[model samples]
Target: MLSLRPGSSGSLAPESSGAVIHPSAKCLIKRSIDILGALVGLVLLGLVAGPIAIAIRLDSPGPIFYAQTRYGLKGKPFTIWKFRSMVQNADLLKQTVSNQAQGLIFKNENDPRITRVGRVLRKTSLDEFPQFWNVLRGDMSLVGTRPPTEDEVSHYSSHHWRRLDVKPGITGQWQISGRSAIRDFEEIVHLDLHYQDIWSPWYDLQVIVKTITILLDRRGAY
Candidate 1:
């Protein structure tokens, strides 16, 4: 089990002073797969990025990409980029919207901030394409825990910090296991910890396959 405490910088680190303790944190095979998979994903993103950009531009008046700070491994902050899927002032208007999900995370199935094009992007999971760059840059893995916002982690309990033991992922157990339907943050944490408990290259491959299947069936992302 990994024990974590908040760092002075607001990040989480191992409670004991030593090399990183998470098994996946030091796995060369996983890193190699992250790199290879990210490369392929980036190529696919490039093929569709133009069309997506055009649609976003025509449907909304904002930058094609939206970048926001998200917590990565050990609660470290990094900029997460996605195709802009909301109005220009979506972040500013967040407080006005009610959070439908329970616990720390926030979600609204009918969020008014989402533009028409944004809905399609989100439905297809194309909005998440740019994170491939994060994977290539080592800020994220192809499969890991869902990256939390700084606000969400602000209220995290010590045990909740354990999920950050691995790098934040583009898709993970939470995503594959009915993400939109799972309203409780603790359940998501359980799945995150479960992934760490079962960290294996084969398991990551399985998750990748499942994610693809969900996307193909149009059953992922809302």
Candidate 2:
């Protein structure tokens, strides 16, 4: 078994201490895919996201972008970026509304804190566009498991950590399968493990196709 210790930066390091999984062929290929997608996504961002940013600014009094720490591959923490979709101090008000989700997840389908522009952004998944930058930075995949927040990760058992063995994604089985329709976090883990276990370029393609279809139909979006 490979043992790990905290590095000077406070992130986990393997016992080998020298070779990270940065040079493997699979890793390189995955990075290439991410880079290509991010480049193309940047074009779309230029065309669409600028107006969305303006609309968000006009509708709310907060930063246009929101970054939250999320657990990535092997439980490493990285900041996940999204368009600000809630009130300026939404985090401070999270406890004001009870979580409607099951397990460690939090959800409020009718969260009063959501702004008008924010509602449109979430419904269209436009709020997710900034994550292409995350893909560019090698912090996320185009398709994988949902990135869990630090608090969510804190509640994870050993079995629940399996989803973190691979990079977190912009969209995954969780999004295409049901998204807000999914109430149980265990079911999300189940779908995520299934994707991780059966992952392939073809599987990624299928999920992307499904995601595009769902987005066009605006199905199961909160």
Candidate 3:
């Protein structure tokens, strides 16, 4: 479980307390880029959302969108939106499935909870398109760390909280660095920290470009 003891500042400190690590967190230029990128993404989403919605409706019986709470910067909770890619009762049935990945995060590439349409959505990452709204709303960035669920963060070590210093992203080190293949949560934390250490507008741009290539090829996604 996480060390929730408050620091002198009355806020929980990361396992290894350190100064703020990401310049992107406070950069007005980075914020501007996020806004622009999110707008473009929303436009693209607008174009495809209809067909995707129809497909989901035909493929399963559930709402068109799925809204869930996710932890963001400093472990703040916010609603993250996605296209519904699972059965309506998937969350309720979570315990019925086994977690293939180790540590705080959970993953199961072959999880039976995923619908047939969900599989394609996960592979193509179309399921993530709705999160552009989160970026536009400032709950997320165009590039940063992956947003963690409450269950995952509940068990975080003090060091694990470091990844939450910046806003969560629709695409980041985890998405580009083998989403499902990299199952170990510690590796993900390493990638998240590495992203913060090396982040610059140029670096974010590179990651975004590489992400596009990966998405186009449908590589390393589900």
On TM-score, the candidate that comes out on top is 1
lDDT of candidate 2 over 56-168, digit per residue (tens): 88998889899898877766778899999899999999989878888989988999999999999899998999999998998888988898886776666666767777788
Q: Each candidate: RMSD to true structure?
A: 2.9, 3.7, 2.7
RMSD of 1: 2.9
What is the TM-score of each predicted model, taking all chains together?
Answer: 0.93, 0.89, 0.92
The per-residue C-alpha lDDT of model 1 at residue 18 equals 41
Cα lDDT tens digits, model 1, 51-76, are 99999999989999999999887678
Candidate 2: C-alpha lDDT: 0.81
Model 2 spans > 4 angstroms off? 1-9, 12-25
Each prediction's number of clashing residue pairs: 0, 0, 2
Candidate 1 Cα deviation (angstroms), residue 131: 0.3
Residue runs of model 3 more than 4 Å from their true location after superposition: 5-21
Ranking by TM-score: 1, 3, 2
lDDT of 3: 0.86
How big is the positional error of residue 163 in model 1, measured in Å on the Cα after superposition?
0.5
lDDT of 3 by residue, 1-222 (tens): 545544553344445556664678888988999999999999999999999999999999989999998877776678899999999999999999999998887788888989999999999999999999999999899899989987777678777888988889988998888878898999999999999888888888888898999999998866
lDDT (Cα, 0-100) at 42 in candidate 1: 98
